[model samples]
Target: MSAFSDSEIAGLKVARQSPLIILQPEFVVRAFTLNERLLVCNPNGRLDAEGALQHAYFSDFTDV
Candidate 1:
């Protein structure tokens, strides 16, 4: 990812599959791996990629 601040990210535009919508959140981003797996930031936190997807926190922010 580029060295962009949270504000910069939020100001930028990102295309979504549902062309009618967009996700330009103004907050810190959660990094992910090349294989589309979320990186583990906390050892005690949920470490399962498959499990994380089931949570409500999961969002379709993956850039096409």
Candidate 2:
């Protein structure tokens, strides 16, 4: 997947039919995984935003 800036948040639409893994330039590839939640990381395994998975899944299934 390509990298996106926070500024592009407006046009960003993630597909919920499948899971999405968004990695920061600092994290290791193996550092990303799905544990019933969204995981964001930096050079050190840090959490930028959690619950992203929830939002995507809900939005996909929602009427809105």
Candidate 3:
């Protein structure tokens, strides 16, 4: 699992999915595991608005 930000917010698999970009650089890898988001690092993490729009995955099955 690749993540834009390696912060605790997006450190684990869960965070990478909906990766929360506490910083700015982590707004690309991915997000959206429990919640809906978009990015590259979908380690079930939060995501940045700009990056979230990159992946845009709705669910576990509906990965966009």
Candidate 4:
């Protein structure tokens, strides 16, 4: 018997859609999840902006 239902598999596929990059007036960021791990990035070409992306990605309260 299959461990996961078809609906659950479909949900997983939907959740794993291609990542997107978000550009804001103050920062640029891209984020996605694979398996159970969350991956995030920034393309602002600044150390602080990159750091902020990392911080937000790792923070426990981050919604995304």
Best of the candidates, TM-score: 1
| By TM-score: ranked, best first | 1, 3, 4, 2
Q: Identify the runs in model 3 with alpha carbons over 4 angstroms from their true place.
A: 1-45, 56-64
Clash count for each candidate, listed in order shown: 0, 0, 27, 0
Steric clash pairs (candidate 2): none
TM-score of 4: 0.17
Question: In candidate 3, what residue range of length 10 has the lowest lDDT sum?
Answer: 25-34
At residue 24, what lDDT does model 3 achieve?
35
In candidate 2, what are the lDDT values of residues 1-64, reduced to their tens digit?
3446555775878866633344333232323333223443452453234444334333444553
TM-score of 2: 0.16
Alpha-carbon shift of residue 59 in model 1 (angstroms): 4.6
Q: At residue 39, what lDDT does model 1 achieve?
A: 52
Tens-digit lDDT track of model 3 for 1-64: 3355556556556444533555633333333242444333765565666554454342333444
TM-scores for all candidates: the values are 0.21, 0.16, 0.20, 0.17
In candidate 3, position 45 carries an lDDT of 64
Reference-based lDDT, residue 9, model 2: 77
Error of 2 at 43 (Å): 33
Candidate 2 lDDT score at position 46: 39
State each model's CA lDDT, in order: 0.46, 0.41, 0.45, 0.41
